[model samples]
Target: MLYKTKGIALSYIRYRESSIIVRVYTEAFGLQSYIVNGVRSAKNKTNRIALFQPLTLLDMVVYHRDDRDLHRLSEVKTPYPFQHIPFEVAKSSLALFVTELLSRTLKEEVGNPHLFRFLLTSIVYLEEATEQYENFHLAFLLQLASYLGFGPENAQEFEDQLRERSLPFLADDAMTDALNTFMSQPIGTPVRLTRAQRADLLDALVAYYRIHFDNLGDVKSLAVLREVLG
Candidate 1:
């Protein structure tokens, strides 16, 4: 079956030095992998490799066959260019972190239009925000928790329960309040947090994930993201 869908590029691995197996999350097809041939060669002219960039938004035509593990692509192109995240060090690291997280976590091959829209919007938010982006990954993760079935929307109550449970990684009162604001506020809301506060809140969010999910394992990009954002 041929399907035209909006896709977010997740990751790709080189094959035979010229081709790549690219994983993309599509609006109409959930997570899918397509084998893109000969794009990495020096003599290539079609510029197919550009569409495989991490977190790039693309309009794609893919051949989907349930019997096959790898699919083929007939068309792929960027709908628009990112304004800044692709160039900024801190933002790019965060993008890589979340992209890896999604690649590891989103395993099913089923369509979800709402989840697809949220992912697209979040990517745009990362690109368009001019300031206060130091906490973008933390905030994004918390919002993602909601979609994953355990959002801390009732911030104060959730914090109180965590504290009562003696969760050692729980944030202090002021940071907890800031997190509450983060949970309650919409994306693009101005947020200010000290480096230490950001780290604390990020730890709290990771702890939240550890409790709710299985195998979210180490976010290796985190150390680099903290060093650069700080």
Candidate 2:
């Protein structure tokens, strides 16, 4: 069967001599793996490989087999043309880190429309955002936690901890308000978090995920991401 779907490229690896295996999170199917043959020797290598980039949003037509494990791509093209995400170093690095995180965490083949929209919007927000890059990844981490059912329940508790830690970044009223909204609302609402609030929220969320998802283990890229923010 042939299926056309919009997908986000999560990761890819070289396969055999000249082929590649790409993992993508599709809107219709939760997660899927596809094989692209002869990409290394393709005439338009640059354009062809660009579609497999980490977190690249693409529109693709794939040959789907119900009983088979590997799928084949018939055609692919970028769907949400990124203007700054693929070009800017900081933005691109964050994209890579987030894509890797999602590729590891999202293991189900069940359709999740809310998670799909959240990721799609987050990428666009990151591309257009002009705020300090320090908090972008943290905000994403927190939101992802909420989507995964681990978000914090009490803003006052989070705020008290921030106060005890003397985190100056939480002084912003808007940031506080966003954190409050997120803590108060049901999981999956779009709450705008401040850079500082985002950091604190992410710290709490990481702890929660670590407690819940044992396989998360230690995120090595976390140190690199922190270094990049610093």
Worst 10 residues of 1 by lDDT: 161-170
Error of 2 at 126 (Å): 0.8
TM-score of 1: 0.91
**Local distance difference test values of all predictions, in order:** 0.81, 0.72
All candidates: TM-score: 0.91, 0.78
Off by over 4 Å in 1: 157-166
Q: Give per-residue CA lDDT, model 2, range 24-45, as digits (tens).
A: 9988887899999888774644
lDDT of 2 at 178: 62
What lDDT does candidate 2 reach at residue 62? 90
Sum up the clashes in candidate 1: 0
